[model samples]
Target: MDYDVFDLGDVRLQSGITLPDAKLAYKTYGRLNAGKSNAIVYPTWYSGQHYDNEWLIGEGMALDPSTYFIIIPNMLGNGLSSSPSTTPPPHDRARFPHVTMYDNVQMQHRLVTERFGVERLELVTGWSMGAGQTYQWAVSHPDMVRRILPFCGSAKTSLHNIVFLEGVKGALTADAAWDNGWYREQPGVGLRALARVYAGWGFSQQFYRERIYEREPLGYGSLEDFLVGFWEGLFIKRDADNLLAMLWTWQNADVGRTPGFDGVAEALAAIRAPAIVMPAEQDLYFPPEDSEWEVAHMPDAELRVIPGAWGHFAGGGLNPVDTKFIDDALKELLAKDV
Candidate 1:
């Protein structure tokens, strides 16, 4: 990936907070065709960056840069991008306002269209929260995105997901030393509690049942020790405030929001592009049933359930995700007269 930076200029978040120093860190691959219509946007997931999925970006891969120009934009709240953790003083973690996945996509739209002068995109694709943004892109700018591929994401974050994130936040705040999510001064150690909550729910019982517990043995002689080590490893370097910001964004994801659209399903129905939703059959956060419900409602949509026990992580865990699924769809979409 060719890492680069985009000076996004001032960004007014959905919270009505204006960040004058806002910028988006992104990476691009392949030569954009002279027509600039062969572009694809691949957004990042929660707690993940563009470089995190380098495995799926080689020759003959589904995201082959050889054929298409791919842009991977780091979502807001990711440290590399203009986020709470790394923002300039006065806009730091303790004072940063809330932003949603829809807000991130709108920023990306400016980067792709206003900055790069790209009139339209061949496709927009991502997993998890990034998938939520991809869905938002299709909704807000139907004429811009030619097609969409959302994997392991929901159009709107479910109430259950919101409750789960609240539980994680509660766990962190209940550590007594948390100090109302403003403990960046001492660098709160209570974040470990939050990470523990995440780890337990991130993976599934199948992971334990299948004996894939190299990091933290599922049936250790002492479960607390394993759980502690598990939490320490993941949250050891990440800041608690930054973690909470990303979780909040993930929890409040929706296709439509302020600064543009409203009514997620209505925006979705307005999409002129074909869509593909690859959901995990056993996904705990975004159930296949949800994807099925979505596909049935979308004007032109298809569903491919990844059969795995990886739960919400099935998208990355089941690497490749049948590349032909994307290839066949792309061939069909781009072949039609626009």
Candidate 2:
């Protein structure tokens, strides 16, 4: 649907930094039941706005407004929310302090508690970086939530992810237009290069294989045209700086290390919510095995491998069928406990 702004007074970031003015853009669907037990959260993935996750949302879907309340909160680094690119000068990336996934959760906490007056959550769910924050919420505020669904996400951002993020930053920093993260008035060509990097890694070889890549027979153009369409149609439409800021935050997403919470696995093991870890069968970024590792340790966690060729992109759904994947899983989770 549509979202407004959430104002959490004098928000403090994980970088030991504070901003007197903090806002998180978000949207809500359905109604919070009398007991407030119907409320579920669907936080956005990297660079994603609340609208991006609406593909799976419909009248009778698992997250059906008829049955439950769904609220999607935009992550901080995303341009739609308070972020490096959106905030004015002196608050831009170069001067902007680091932000951790915990920082994001803290803001979400304010959104749920203050804005919505939600005392307890039926569930906190998300994909990719959104999933990571869902995990963080489970660990940091165990008693506040009833269940969690983390899709194609990891407990911690891997070193490989970090290195990759650094490379994107390097792409922007190296580009003459980036101006060391100080460019504010104009578009950064380096950011476009960063998006190109995403074009390569965001999906899986399996996704490009066994047919979505094929054309003519399917009635589309040649394979080359499809690839070209993917880049020009998707990447070309997104703002480069916004994408880079989102990428930077995602690459470094680690609730434990960033928050100085050293006992990460222990911390995760203590999550009180019944959890469903949905790992993509073909995902390389946040492998299914990692979710299995997490599920094993969590006091109450289950592993649900999504059988799909979408890989890391197997989330919130790019198409209707993709959307159904999320709908069915959430329906099951909502049925089981929440």
Best by TM-score: 2
Question: Residue by residue across 1-338, what tens digits does model 2's lDDT show?
Answer: 35789877677676768865777899988888888888888899876789888876778888788878888989886877777776776676666556678888888888888888898888899999989989888877888989898998987887776776777667655777666655654444664666666655666787666666453322336555654565445554555566666676687776566344576687776788988889888787787888898888789888988887777877747645566776787788788844
User: Which residue pairs in candidate 1 have backbone atoms (N, alpha carbon, C) closer than 3 angstroms, thus clashing?
Assistant: none
lDDT per residue (tens digit) for residues 1-338 in model 1: 35777887788887788876787889988878888877889898877778865545666665678888888999888777877788887888757678787678888998898767897998888888878888888887888988888888988888888888888888777876656656635345566777777776765678646645443223444455556655456575666667778888888777756345566666667777788788877777788888887777689888977665666766663334434454454455556565
Q: What is the TM-score of each candidate against the true structure?
A: 0.87, 0.90
The global C-alpha lDDT for each of the candidates, from Candidate 1 onward, is 0.75, 0.76
Residue 288 of model 1 has an lDDT of: 84
For model 1, state the Cα shift of residue 44 in Å: 0.7
Considering every candidate listed, which one attains the maximal lDDT? 2
- lDDT (C-alpha) at residue 17 in model 2: 80
